[model samples]
Target: MGEQKVKTLAGDELKAIKEAGSGKKKSRKTTSGQIYISSSYNNTIITITDDKGNVLTWGSSGMVGFRGSKKSTPFAAQRTMEEMLKAMKGIGITEVDIFIKGIGTGRESAVRALNGSGIKVRMIQDRTPIPHGGVRKKKPRRV
Candidate 1:
């Protein structure tokens, strides 16, 4: 009969294996980032990005378990910001510039939440689109 060999890892190797399997991989450390808050009539989404505009993480009211009309509420936006800040903090993001879009009820609350989370906001810019002249009006309907 052929001989069979069983191999086992050392204690340190087993510990490393366990640690790797625990799902706490180290994330890239970033000091400053950009926060994009899009608050529409139906939902509010917050995205964390690097200074160069590379998204690191994002969260939305819908992602935070809000549904229907609740998704657009200020409270839901606040909660979503809290969740996003918690995640961003893990990656060492302490300062940010806020860019806001849309005109939903959650807009201001989300900004307040971000500030309250201990992140230093450098600037807040409104990116909501405004029509300069808008499209041409439709022609009169025939009688």
Candidate 2:
């Protein structure tokens, strides 16, 4: 019977790993940004982006461990927004323009959570698309 020897990293390998991590720069601080919340029937997704539309971070009810119907609930949306707020605070975001889309149970609650968290909402826009008159209806079929 033979015993297998465990391999360990040498000093150079360890130093390389440490230096690689340390070389990365910290994220830039942003004070004004936009929050895009899409609350569909199945899930609520919240994304924080810079003024120019560069995404900073995002959170979703499903990503937070909510499943099935629960992901569309207000509570799950609130939790998702809470997670987003925590991430926003790290980058010094204090003001936001909120763009909301979709029809879901979480719509109002997500907005409320963001407001209650002390982040100044400059504007709230509903970006949901409303369909205009389109193609003509099909002819009635005989039963």
Candidate 3:
């Protein structure tokens, strides 16, 4: 009763492990003016809300087939926006306040695609805030 067996993850066993961990109960309700857009190091997410700012619909780069390598591409973001817009159209949203949060190519392309699809963006703000630095340090002598 000394040595314990080690588990290995590869191929289908790995896939099964991954799939088993996916999904959670959607704990929030979708309502009808809130549009939240964000892009992280891994994914891009767009959420639409009802008049009360409750999420009415939402989409992600993953949901639009922009998985893994596709997440950083402009085409991925464009597709994400298009699909998100289509979902929004079904719920009767005409205008939105775009909240962009990343420096990726998706930022601009996604907004342009939304416009081309007839969703008027009321305002565009660079939500990426720059933190303040105190001062520059003096350079040391080269040795």
Q: Give TM per candidate.
A: 0.77, 0.79, 0.66
In the range 1-143, model 1's lDDT, one tens digit per residue, is 99999899999999998987897755778999999999999999999999999888899999999999999999999999999988998889989999999999999999988777777889999999998999999999999
Candidate 1 wrongly placed segments (more than 4 Å): 1-26, 138-143
Cα error, candidate 3, residue 40 (Å): 3.3
The lowest-lDDT stretch of 10 consecutive residues in candidate 2 is 19-28
Sort the candidates on lDDT, descending order. Answer: 2, 1, 3
TM-score for candidate 3? 0.66
Give RMSD to native, each candidate.
Answer: 5.1, 5.6, 10.3
Tens-digit lDDT string for candidate 2 (78-100): 99999999999999999999999
1-143, model 3: which lDDT tens digit per residue?
A: 69999987779998998779887744443323556778666777888776567667788888887668788777787888888877777667777777788766677777778778766677777787566895788999899
TM-score of 1: 0.77
Clashing pairs in 2: none
TM-score of candidate 2 against the unseen true structure: 0.79
Cα lDDT computed for each candidate against the true fold: 0.92, 0.94, 0.75
